[model samples]
Target: MSIKQFLDKILKNWPVKVTCFVMAVLIYFFHQISTIDKKTFVVPLEVKSEGAMVLSGGYERHRNVKIIVRARAEQLASVSEKDLRAYVDLSSQSSAGQHNFPVLLDLEERILLMDPLEITASPDSVPLSIEERDVKFVGIRPSVSGIPSHGYTLSKITSDPATVRVEGPRSVVSKITYMPTEEVSVQNATSDVTKKVSVLNRNSLISVGTGTFSVNARIVPQGMVKTFSDIPVSFDNLRDDLAVSGEPVFVDVIVEGELLDIEKLSADSVRGSVDCSFILTPGHYEVPVSVTVPLGLTVNSKSRETLSLDVVLKPEETLPDSSAVNDGEEKDAENTQPQEEMEAVPEDVTDIPQSDAVPEPQIQGV
Candidate 1:
């Protein structure tokens, strides 16, 4: 119809037409209001390292999420966030394998008329698995256990609890053999060694290093003995311009060890020193002396007494013309010095090296 005809028809029935339009509008508005009261929960999602059994405000196992539901307000006042839970319909959809992805929300029966106001249930997922790890065992390595205590010689060392159990990945578990103990260093020791030590390893495959192991050390006995030989005298770095003035320069060979060692060693094991060349001419000289100890023996020396030397230039050799030599006395000072000397190793030291050595074992803690 043309616009004039449509207008004429509406004007002829304006009251009824307006009444119909108003009814239609009222129906649409009521339809919109009917949809408002649908009850649904929106709980906030939360995930935890292990499990999410959180405490409520009053220290209960369940927590609450504030949610806004379109349900009846009267029903809501009677309900709480804790009473309702999010219903993730995984029952129909299969994102989770055989396991159920539990809805973290506390859902109420659909018969309830309440809706959650400000609904927000946080989302969360489960761990891959919930099983505890297994335990495992491994071998042990003990060291620094060889040195002895003061006055005692270590004879032998051994581990008592040698093996430990651990658990973890199969690959890493296979690569490991033994765990090492912390380094033990005991000084001036001459006694049997013993200590409880821990193993060192950090493989998730093994857990037994968390435990303890026993270490045992053995030692031999020998009583007091003197410093076997005199101290060895060494020459410090010197200028070539200054020359030593003697042949057979002296150096003391010092030997000191466990008292028993000094007593058991022999002079043959120790010797005094003399210079390499008789050509020493002017300044200080250092001579070398060597000491020999019986097989399987260790030596230590104190600096109480060191070997000295008496040296002299040839008596017939005239003094040099230079003022450096003749400035004071006009005589050859090179002739004034004496050759080196040292007390000979006592009969005890000369024999110990050859005589039944069986020196003590070491049980050092480092």
Candidate 2:
């Protein structure tokens, strides 16, 4: 056919021909898509900051992302969430305010081999607040719970590395006053309790330099106070000739010790006394009261700090009068002489009258 005739034949029924060709392309495309499969995955969204910038609050909602991939069945079987990485780059961001960043994806070499694959994410971009990085040193407070064993009490609690350094966004780091450690239980503990616990950070944006700390709890016996009343005060190191002349001194003693030890104490067990050895002569004086208690007990207080008493000499025995003894001896001698003279004339004077005989020997009787 001539060139003009050939061109005319090609142009013949151009509308119908174009329509048929479009139908065929559509049919082929539908047929190819029928064999493809789709899959969904949830993955963590990483943030990359090459400079001193970070994502502040409201970023936790965007921490994870949902990814959708379309590929042939065989290709989709080899794909997994681990093979893909999603992140937002904040390397160039330095301002301190809210910011919106586009989500980026990185596919591994093996996943990239999936030919004719389609991939898309649910959220193409996320909104985040970017702020300047900050660092602060905060004290660590240990958390303790539960009571100790019976007859025991918690004495003190201590933590090693009492302070730690925290680094995060300026806005979040500035609000934190102190860090708290995980709880440690001392239930039914007889002795000391020690543990290594983790530090808890309520804010997701904040990062701690040290993740863990050492905690030590001291447990000891419970203390109690016992009041011993009516303890009599005694004289210690006093001379035998000297005596304390005053009302009987008594004191009320207060002692403190462990519960078990204090329970065994009584009024009689506590002794109070005063030192009288310092007084050389007998006189009125104020002596300090000294108390003695059982071993392992502490004296808390005393009712009387000092005792006022009068020290005096003891009374002596009375003796007989010397003049009376001399008079008796002289009268006895005079009676003895008269009795001897009467005895010599007694036989011859027997005939005399009774009154006359007595008058003759009327000497003084001793």
The TM-score, computed over Cα atoms with residue i paired to residue i, of candidate 2 is: 0.77
lDDT of 2 at 63: 78
lDDT of 1 at 308: 42
Q: Give one digit per residue, the lDDT tens place, for model 2 in 5-121.
A: 998988899999899999999999998899899999989998887689987866778879988988888889989888999999987566877777888999998777787788887
TM-scores of the candidates in the order shown: 0.28, 0.77
lDDT scores of the candidates, listed in order: 0.50, 0.87
**Cα distance off (Å), candidate 2, residue 333:** 26
State the lDDT of candidate 1 residue by residue for 164-257, as single tens digits: 7765434445666777787555455666567888877643223464666778766676444345434343334433444334343333345545
Model 2: weakest 10-residue lDDT segment is: 345-354
Count of backbone collisions within predicted model 1:
88
Q: Cα-based RMSD of the predictions, in order?
A: 32.6, 11.3
For all candidates, what are the clash counts? Answer: 88, 0
Give me the candidate number with maximum lDDT. 2
Which stretches of candidate 1 lie above 4 Å from their native place?
1-137, 143-155, 182-185, 209-211, 219-366
